[model samples]
Target: MEKKCVNEKKCGSCKYLHMTYKEQLKKKEEFVKHELEKCPELKGHFKPIIGMENPWNYRNKVTAVFDRDRKGNPISGVYQEGTHRVIPVEKCLIEDELADKIIGTIRGMLRSFKIKVYDEDTGYGLLRYVLVRRGFATGEVMVVLVTASPIFPSKRNFTNALLKAHPEITTVVQNVNNRTDSLILGDKQQILYGKGYIEDILCGCRFRISPASFYQINPVQTEKLYSKAVELAGLSGKETVIDAYCGIGTIGLIASKHAKNVISVELNPDAVRDAIVNAKVNGIKNVRFYKADAGRFLTQMAEEGAKADVLLMDPPRNGSSEEFLRSAALLGPGKIVYISCNPVSLGRDLGVLKKLGYRAEECWMVDMFPWTAHVETAVLLVRKP
Candidate 1:
């Protein structure tokens, strides 16, 4: 099929926009297969999961950086690749309609308040970016205003104006990002209106997400991914399961129905607290959350003769670290479900597991991030005698 870039050379989000969806999927599948081939032991077991039909407009949330135009009017959108030039986005195809509306409202609010755009050189600006997250099931919305400093009186008035304007918003948070160079949230957060956090339901469990917490951006695909992970774990009523990197304990909570005991390990204390609250609200006592580094906890467990029948991992985009993978392999769980967003790193880590005498029993590909070059994969590895 012929391929063309919609916003060719303008939008930096998709470098492969010039390629057709079919061609993009094909390229991604080939890339995954080749990476797996790097480990001869995984050559026969590697499988390609099918890509999604509608890849565009799949993202549930979008974080748009703010800048000012030549006229000194605030421009709200993403920056051009490798440069700080602001690209005003009238309609982002990747986000939902609510996200677009939130962006439009924020732009209007900035204009109405005459807010100054933060300059990278001077490091002065009231507004930095607007983040919007939508709940698929409840139609609830959360608007997060990221700024270089605390909201001024005028900006606070602007936030009040927004809440009065849009009642759909369930949570409005102002994140203070004073650091000169960083993409993360600042040391403090002030709740401007309503609840400080929003609720998202996954696999029949409700999870409260703060601005800094990490949750899946794509709700529909995440549900499918979590369901698949639970299935691959093959949870039995008598089995003990360990969910590593259990962000908010979504996987562990879902798997609790089938497993007798679930131990969820997360490095972030805030996430761990949220996980515990989620478990309590859901009337689930079988799940326990530990606020510790995943790799270190697994290594300690291995040294202490602690073992789990099933081990489930949903690591970050970089995939699991070498130490974590080696520790997991040494634990010698009956089954290991490794979920990853980056195929290259997943393949690399799978090679390490192969040397530890584990074989990839099954592989599934999920088009979690469609339209772009990213894909989510899940592999179930079993220890071989």
Candidate 2:
């Protein structure tokens, strides 16, 4: 029998914790195959879903909401499913063990430091949320303190105490989120200690990770997922590739080693800056990054008769926009490799691509989130002659 999590029902993050690993993989495979079947042309193309050898404690990133219990004591955990109530979780099977311990230490230190946990009702207190990111390969850790305001009382002392407890922490950042919304990160940020960012190795390349970058949460499976995506591209050292929606240039930098040249584009300035630094750090010169809307940039390139041999896109969970799909078709890449987290949105976008003369050739699933319903998918589409 699987050992059930104490807060499994309340936390509601992992729906398959009770099932065996094999059962979880089978369920996910069936779920993804069913989703792809919605587009008949995409049927019979799904390869075996890749699963992790050790799925527990695979999440390198952890975010917890701050609250006070009836006794007015500080606590930290995730929000309950479909509700704003924070369910305190001391340890999570899917989260990094060190991150959990670090969060526990921070939670305990808040009371002694006279720091008040934020109350959403009256909008009072200092700390709002705590986000921790750990590099599985490098053993580097980052802690982001989400506060309601910039004025942090005894900020130095609090940081010193936290560091004293966990010297493994590489950096500490203060993110001021004064809004009433549910977003964990705010616009304003100041580095409280060390360098503001941490580095991690992915697919034999080092990537600079900032707090807001859209990096994969599970690094172990990420290597496999990206390796499959690159394999599907069939790069022969002569292909010109375009990586759209490129966050910190993870895929582009990885693909650059094989392709002749890679063009990567993203809208976020912070991400673009980090991507440039990442390229420099990795000493990769063949890939170039642009801070522009991917769809618009590709459309302009297509209008200029610029051509690419392959197009790689890893859009958000909502999937790529129709504009981006149309522009992708306009660019007329011989092959398209799409990495999607949401199967429904992927099906919808696949149908759009089908009408644009692209046919789904093969699809592979990577179980990045082991216990959760969410699964990462990579699909290869070829332009029909």
Candidate 3:
């Protein structure tokens, strides 16, 4: 296998744009294992992390900007690194079949309407970017059309045209981003068509996703990730588990049946509301949702004498803050299940936990982001007696 970079030096999305899929997976595995060795307690427990068999076309969502080529043809795709010039990607090897089809369809429609693509230089044009998200379990598609202006009469007509043409699109949201900056999403959103949200089923738990809410992009591998996390938690129906940074309460909802009680903490109010709705939809009553930061919630729980036999932490890519890590270490549950998308940060946090008298008993990796360098990991750490 040879190294392959789709746009070579043009696109910065893929840092390892020059490496083959196999080489990338191998390098990632070695990287995780070597980092684990830095934690003396985790040295022997670290195993060869699993890799995805099909390492291409696995992305469920793609955000592509709109631009124009030298020939004046409307080009809808991502931008080249360090330049506003768009990388005219007719087909992305990392996205699913539906994503590719939708991109092609939208590109043709934009060309037909002669819709002026967003120009970063002059800050003119209506169309800014297209966000496409697909449900892996239900095969539902949500298309969010972001524009620099309101839904003009012509753009509304275009939106109607898309709905009339494609029935697979379950939700169509028009997001207005009138700012001159490069922020893709705005606070204002209006449902243009179909249901306002999409549903995703994981471990028999259904989750509702909004345009701004964060859900696992890879559904198949996310099941594997959550399953591994549950296994590491060692739920026995008698333990209370705290799922920290629990986005939409998927982990807590799924693990509720195995644990006596599940407390889910999330910062986003929308996500918390969605988590409550999901719990009701799934008929889960053992889970509780808290609209608060995970670290603050944990500190409050400690103050209130709320004890948990097991704790699950799934922080964002930036990993847990030092204060959060310190609070988690102070709580010192019997078992800790750490799920991380960034192995480097995972290793660093695991070092903190090890110093707090917790030892890594098991570690596994899930190839959540295929065809990309990102990997998800699950680790079980036990309090040393």
Candidate 4:
């Protein structure tokens, strides 16, 4: 029998908590196989799903919303799915243990600090949410305070208290998000303590992660996923590679060591900035980052008569756009390694790629979100000769 979480029904984060890990893996494998069956080119090319040996507490990034219970005590946890009700979680099974503890400490200190929880309805309070990110290999921690206003009273004392409680914390940043929308972060930010960012090692490559950058939530599976992605690319140190939707240049930098050169592109300026720094930090001189839309960049590369040996694309959950797919064909890379978080979108894109003269040869799944229903996939497609 599988162990159950105390607030399992309310939090609704771990959809497969009731099922054993083996059963969960089987379910995801079957789901991916079923999704891919829609595309004929991908049929009979499915590989076994990669499941984690220890799946619990695998989430490196933890975000909890702040609110007060009826008794006026401060609390922090995730919001109940599809609703605004905040489910008070003392500890979560999927989150990092120390990160969760630090969040709990912050919640406990709110009352003593005379800090008010942000009220969504009345547009009041200081803190709206708390986000914690920990580096698995380096044990570096970054705490981001999402606030309704920039002014934080007694912030110095609060930072000192938090550091005293959890000395492992490397940095603290205050992000002002005063909007009424559901977004977690705002445009404005200020560093309250330490450096504004934290660094971590992935696939022997160091990466700088900021509050807004898109780093994979699961570090353990990320290594497997990225290693497999680069392996499937079949880089020969003589091939030019393109890494699209490259956030902070994680996959690009990892693949750089094996390839002749890598061109990474992202729309977010902050991520592009971090990617450039990450390449320098790793002393990887063969890779360059561009702050442009992936589709547009690929289209221009094709127009410039440039050719790449491999194309590495990790698009959003919605998958790659048709414009990007068409341009990828125009560029005509011999192999295209597509990494996707959503299988349904992956299948749709596979069909589009097949029409554009590419065929999915092999595909594998990595269990990035253990108890959750989500799975990550990497597919290798070769140009149809």
Candidate 5:
């Protein structure tokens, strides 16, 4: 069965969508294998890649960039593959269906309002982007209207009109980005309607997700990936756990049941706040969230002679920095479960950890983003005696 996306060439987001899903998994497995081969020490520890049962419409979030169509009418869609050119995405196979619908509805509303979209060349406009995020399990929705400026004409009428059109929308926020740069959202934000946040259930825990919160786009695969990481950690209800680069404390809070305590470190304060609220919502008392640099926090822990039995790190796609790996070595966790988005970065970081008395013992690849050339993996590392 072919996927539902039509703009494959114009919107090159789905690079591997041409092949069958099985073939996609095979190719991804080979890619991870080749990346791991760069690190000869853990070359043989690669396990069979975990795939999704049904990969369609998995993303909980979607964003539409504002651009003018050839007809000079304001349009919104994704950027073309490897180009700044806007390729209007009417639908996406990977994004949640409701999110796509809401985005379309917003675009229609913008057109109806005659709202001038920010032109990158002219720099005079109101809306820059429309970001729609839906709670996969909660049925809640949040719409972030990214504008070039905070001053929105007829704001109240526009809000009323949008809410009237889409009664399912739970919240609406306006993010102002006055700069000409390509950044989607600015630091200044105002809640135009509702509570300005949404909640979702992941791994049997409730999480509060804001516009800035780093919740996983693919919630279903994220549960599988995090579960694999927790299982790899081998938590025994007696060991302390440390979650480095823990975004909103998803991994750490989920692992709280199996561990005596979990200390999650994040650089984003907004995420840390959400993590704390999520902990309270889940009734998870054993976990604590700290807003600090993960590397610096780990370094401080090492200096204080503090140690954790289990360390779980889910770094960004660029991968872990050498300072983070160095801090991890100094922390000296008995077991380290690394959840990585990029295999090449994982390979590079593993080479660094190998010199620090840590070796990869088990590895599992989870197909988080199907149809895309992205792969997520969890690896268990044990300190050499």
Candidate 6:
């Protein structure tokens, strides 16, 4: 029997809570298989879907928006899907227990510190959103208070109160978002406590996770996913690997162990910085980090006559762009490992890559996100002879 979620409709986080856990995984696996079947090169190549033992509370990061209710009381939670109305979640089954408690505690301190929730209409308030990131392996936590402006009234007292309540919190940061736009994080940030970032171990590598670093939410499955991706690359300790869209160099660093060298490219300069630091911290000498557009970098590599034996790409939910596929085709890597969050976009991109002399070999579904419509699919593409 499926466990009914209390905040399913209002929270808008889990889309498949009504179905049993088994049904959820099966549905996701079938969905990926169905999408990949459209491409002739991907037919009958999907491996068994990897399901989680205990999928609840797997998310390491939680983002809560602050707003006012109809009665003008401060509220915090996720917006109701596509709107600005905060859902006011007291307890979420999927969220980390301590992180939710901290957010709830901060919500209570709003009145004590004279903090006003930001208003999207008037844009006159201070508090905007609360972001909490936890290190699954290290038991360290980072709290980021998103504010409309740098001026936080009684900021010292507020942070002290939060730390006193949650002694396990490692860091507290205040990020200012003066714009009226929908971005959750701002440019300017100040550390109110501890280091501005937390650390976590994934696949035997230590990674520094900042308030904005792109660490995987599901740490356990992340190890499995990266391991599988590296396995599919079939490195012989002599191959040159290119990690594209490499946020924090998670995949690139992991691949460094098996490959001779790794070149990781990311668009975000901040993530690239963290990736560089992560490589040094992990004592990995063979991986190089580059802050550039992955497509343009691959194109440049092609123009320079540099050859990559394997191209490991973990694109965003929207998947890789056609330009990237063309660039990848020009580079002519022997094997291309694609990690995708959206199977539809993966299939669409695979079609484009097929025209680039790449044949899809094996696809596997790894359920990093449970009770949700989202699934991670890893596919290996071998260049056709």
Better of 1 and 2 by lDDT: 2
The 10 consecutive residues of candidate 1 with the worst lDDT sum are 1-10
lDDT for each residue of candidate 6 in 1-385, tens digit (9 for 90 to 100): 4566667987677999988889989999889988887577666677889988988889999999998888988888888887777788877777888899999999999987888999888978999999999999999999999999998888998999999999999999999999877888998999999989999999999999888779899998999999999999999999999999999989899889998999999998779889999999999999988999998898888889888889999998998889888988888899999999999999999889888888899998899999889999999999999
All candidates: TM-score: 0.93, 0.98, 0.93, 0.98, 0.97, 0.98
TM-score, predicted candidate 1 vs. hidden true structure = 0.93
* Tens-digit lDDT string for candidate 1 (348-367): 88888888888887877777
CA lDDT, candidate 4, residue 362: 94
Error of 2 at 103 (Å): 0.6
lDDT of 2: 0.92
Candidate 2, 1-385: lDDT as tens digits:
3767988888788999888988999998998888877567666677899999888899999999999988888889998888988888899988999999999999999988999999999999999999999888999999999999999999999999999999999999999999998778999999999898898999999998999888899999999999999999999999999999999999999999999999999999889999999999999999999999988998899889888899999998899889889988888899999999999999889989998999998999999999898999999999999
lDDT of each candidate versus the true structure: 0.81, 0.92, 0.81, 0.93, 0.88, 0.90
Off by over 4 Å in 1: 1-8, 39-48
Candidate 3, residues 65-148: lDDT per residue as tens digits? 888888877887777888777888767667777877787788789867767877778888888888988888888999988888
Q: How many residue pairs clash in each candidate?
A: 0, 0, 0, 0, 0, 0
Cα-lDDT of candidate 5 = 0.88
lDDT of 5 by residue, 1-385 (tens): 7865678878877888889999999999999888877556666788888888998999888989988888977777898877788888777888888888877777787776778888887788788899999988989999999988888988889988888978989999998889867678789999999999999998898999999889999988898898889999988899999998988888899999899999999998889999999999889999988899888899888889888888999998899888888888888898899899999999988888888999788889999999999999898899999
Between prediction 3 and prediction 4, the one with superior lDDT is 4
TM-score for candidate 5: 0.97
Clashing pairs in 2: none
The deviation in Å at residue 255 for candidate 4 is 0.6
Candidate 6: worst 10 consecutive residues by lDDT? 1-10
Q: Write the per-residue lDDT of candidate 4 for residues 218-249, one digit (tens) a residue.
A: 99999999999999999999999999999899
State, as a TM-score between 0 and 1, how close model 6 is to the true structure. Answer: 0.98
Clashes of 6: 0
Candidates 1 and 5 compared by lDDT, better number: 5
